[model samples]
Target chain A: MDREEIRVAVLRIEGTNCEEETATSFRNLGVEAEIVHLKQFYSDMIRFEDQRSIFDYHCIVFPGGFSAGDYVRAGAIFSARVKSVLRKDLEEFIKYNYPILGICNGFQILAELGALPGFDEDRPISDRPEMALAINDSGRFECRQTLLRVESRKCVFTKEIEKDKLQIPVAHAEGKVVFPRGREEEYLEKLKENEQLVFRYVDDKGNYSGYPWNPNGSFYNIAGICNVTHTVLGLMPHPERVTFDYRKNSFGDGYYIFKSVISYLEKI
Target chain B: MITFLFCEKLIVFMIADVHIELKEGVADPEGESTLKALRLLGYKRVKKVSSVRVFRIEIDTKSKEEAEKEIKEICERLLANPVIHRYRINWIG
Candidate 1:
């Protein structure tokens, strides 16, 4: 056993609900994965005193769950705490081009923190963040094994993933991608031109259809996106849930994403 | 003028401050309702409509400005969609 395997840190908040599964996924890939509780990382008595800096780990994962009870929207409250405490550390992490993955609720948190698409340098919080995870068009929680087509060749996390579509699972009610009022065209064009859009929903026949084709009704059927440097990734799919071969459905390709993450880390 | 309306006679109204552009491809259900209502009242050429909602919350604070500032965070994170909604507070003296 390689004792000095890649150090993977799974960030856990008070109401966070995906620590165990996230740990298991990384451990299976021969990585040192640990669930670090946010309270333990931060001081008990005051704010920002003992907060765990993102620099402590090689790869940081904001895993899925109902963080902060989704009280003030899905990930707003938790993301605000992270921003307030670890803002400088997060900026350095992004500057150094370290890998950061935000899955499901984490994606929403990342968007709220102005970490996705990477256009929020020194911008006011009142200014709307460029991307959003709106309520699903169907307006219901959907939990099913989903198929995602790898669309971008630039993302480091998806580098080893097959160029073709891969099977994964998506379980969420708010996953639709929305841009600021009049910036839809410009945003989509920039995302596509820069190869930031990493995945899209596609049918088994490889055709981009509707409803299930774009499970959450995201614009451009976008299922995942990465920052310009491809070091930061945010996706709606629950890749950790389907990392094992046994968990695969008859047509599941879930293992590919885990494999991709492992391969990317090894290269780095 | 201050008589209370009975159970079925209650009148409901909402005030909103939407921060959205009337661009194509965006959905405005509230605006659509207003347009339809105006049409029913025999008005014509109601080219466009846009709207928002406001809720006045009273908290214990001497400074109205400070109170508004504090509540804005709650509103942004909870009540209002920062993506398309803007809010201002009005005090009733």
Candidate 2:
């Protein structure tokens, strides 16, 4: 596929606040990216010209935000709406190996949709969620620059970040990644074996630490993860927020994620 | 017996109060903070506090058992995150 033909959709719905910056991140990489409202994809009330098809884009993104007010659990409403309406389209999208990225509340939506911790490679979408991003242990919204150690090179989104660690900002009250109580070890082992684990929260020294360093007290200090195919990714950090190179002493670590996806889309 | 048969013919409305709470081992900062606030207010007897989300769903079904089952399905599928939270259903008709 030609790079000019690559189209990315930064999908959004009511209360989703980060679609603009996320779309801009892809646009910065010289690709066409649009902030597409979820309503435009499924709502009958939307104007005919405003409606969109998931098949039109090569990449889809669920940007961070408190969608539908984050009521009935964070991302529950958004996830349910998508699953109720766009499940087949999304499932087909995944089966086709198109890239899907989720950040913060977007991550929560993916978990709710059972699109991450994808243990069954044959089934790109799970019938039920296997994990969750629960409330932070701190009991309050945590907004800070968190250090993340890149743990997997197999993910298409992180192939360009050769560095062992990245400093990305996270702002959420529900970013703690947790698995089912008794299945933690088994899940971690499988994730490690499949090389699906993408990032782990680490301290400034790149060591797994506790409290504020680990932010939400995520299980095993996990910050991000991808599917077995490495095509679908969900993370609690906002990569788009730090993709600018003009910032002081900026490494623009997040820019590489967009670049990596663009490269993958170009190759296939 | 006649009244009971007639009652069955009438539409029955029920409200299911579903309460969802984080599992015992999961950390709950909101509940903990509320506990701390109570402690600071000199409620020395308070030991622990946990938070739960309550969802009241209205259903129209003739059989209470059927209503319960449907509400349970809703709770399991969408009302709660089974991974970290457990939900209980209480029906009031």
Candidate 3:
């Protein structure tokens, strides 16, 4: 579709701090982007003009934040709220191949909602989340810039990114993506076979490393993943934080994520 | 200053205790940190350290069977993430 027709909803709830940056990045790309409160889609008290439907947008994003204070778990409250209130409509949204991008806490929410590692095509959102973004191995909030190797050829968000690796900032206490207790090996193999794995943490030399390099100690150094169809993607890094070059005002590493999906939408 | 209903049961308040912790094989960073601190404080004999979070919830149902089923569903849906954490529910009279 045309860039003018590409409307993006940078979705947020209270404590979601990145909606402005995410929406600004999209607007910079010449597309229509709005910072939409999650309530606007559900609250009956919202004025008619202020109300929104997920179907009203070409794409929707869950931006990074300590949503709902990250209580109980990083994204549990937010994800449960979404699943309880907007489950049916969200499933329908996925059916249309509209890209859903989740960054940082957003990634945590998607994992909680069973939207990542979504194995079955027939069920875009699983009844139970197949993965979890646990706390960092450091036992403290890790805020640092990490290198990521683009690991998926099928991911719509990164397809236009010609570079094999990108430097993105990650700031969160919980981002260590883990599979079920004993099924780590099995799930890793399935992710590889299905090509749903998106990004892997790497070192300066671009090799998978440990400790500060891997950041949260995510299994297989996995930094991001997507659903089977690649329409949905969830990653720990904040791509919105670095979408433009300050000096040249040119596109940065994260800008291509937005660019690629818009191009994909244009084609489909 | 309030009146009690005559039909109210004398002992009907039900509580379900949910104990959640990381799966056995999963790394417990917080517990590990605590263990390290204990060792530094001269407690060298401490073999290991582990931790769990307990949530006490009041279920509306009076029947034990119904309360058990509802608590299980609650644990599965919201109280705990099955991927990294496992939970055990205990009933309190």
Candidate 4:
């Protein structure tokens, strides 16, 4: 028996459209990946009233898409549903140290659920119960292949890239990660120190500075961030869409993210 | 004829768009539409919304002195992006 086989579960809800690409990416990297629809946990289809425990899987993914049709704000409606309905299961899964990735809409959901940094780990919930992914600095949706500098060395998804920068594609309108007042530099500094600041917007030369080179105009050119534990990561880029050789834009390296995950699983 | 009343002059709401700009190369059509929607929503009373991102701030400061200082810091640090987005302050007590 091949114990080295890694099992990953790509979660699919009604509006989710990236599971196939994400699954394909994982499969191409020699990991056993499966697309599990949210309906499977519940016998009914109309409402997301049913969802089972997610402890069976080693890795879970919340792929990109306009989940819940971006109603009541992007990812807000769907994330509320998930947090309220599957709260216990998700909490348990995290307690066990399971790996989770939220891309785009998924990132929105994670932040809304207080599951990204789980600020409670450091501060009381009363201080700030709600988090926000504000409108882009450009005041618009940015869609194109852009360069991202891998700044964090502690995350599970980005460890294998090793390189200081990665050229990945991004498609989003509300990709800004904003916290309360007076918390910008401190939050970024903490993320940097924790190695949770995984990806940053950069230029062709891998310099993380200036406009046009940095899309969305994230603070400190931030593109992605992970939780304190590194088991959970939330990013603005769509790695699943460009995880194959043919999908690469002008730059041709997108498989390393999946490769890194698989490599970690193999070692385990 | 419309009747107008004057008193000690209470501060009325002043609409301010806390514009946030993406990097020069970044694209943002949604932000454009939002500006359009603001116009369609009958916000024409104000001169030139200019399609910038807007954030509503509610604070209690009896004096304009304290209000200006607090709001400026808020916008500079969190409410607006200093690098890409420039903020215009409007005092509404």
Q: Recovered native contacts in candidate 1, as a fraction?
A: 0.20
The number of the candidate with the highest TM-score is 2
User: What does the TM-score come to for chain B in model 1?
Assistant: 0.56
Using all chains and alpha carbons, the TM-scores for the candidates as numbered come to: 0.77, 0.96, 0.94, 0.70
A-chain TM-score in candidate 1?
0.89
Q: After superposition, how far is residue A226 of candidate 4 from its true place, in Å?
A: 0.4
DockQ: which is higher, 3 or 4?
3
Tens-digit per-residue lDDT, A1-268, candidate 2: 7888899999888999999999989987788998999889988999998899999999999999999999888998899989889989998899889999999999999999998888776777787788999889988899999999999888999987888998899999999999999889999999999999999999888889998999998999999999999999999999999997685766487887888899999999
Instruction: Please give the lDDT score at residue A83 for candidate 1.
Output: 73
What's the TM-score of chain B for every model shown? 0.56, 0.82, 0.81, 0.47
Candidate 3 C-alpha lDDT tens digits along A117-216: 8888778989888999998999989999999999986989988989999999999999998999778899988889999889999999999999899999
Best by DockQ: 3
Cα error of candidate 4 at position A239, Å: 1.2
Query: DockQ (Cα-based) per candidate?
Result: 0.16, 0.73, 0.78, 0.06
Error of 4 at A208 (Å): 2.2
- Please give the ranking of all candidate structures by TM-score, highest first, separated by commas: 2, 3, 1, 4
How would you class the docking of model 4?
A: incorrect
Question: What's model 4's lDDT at A17?
Answer: 77
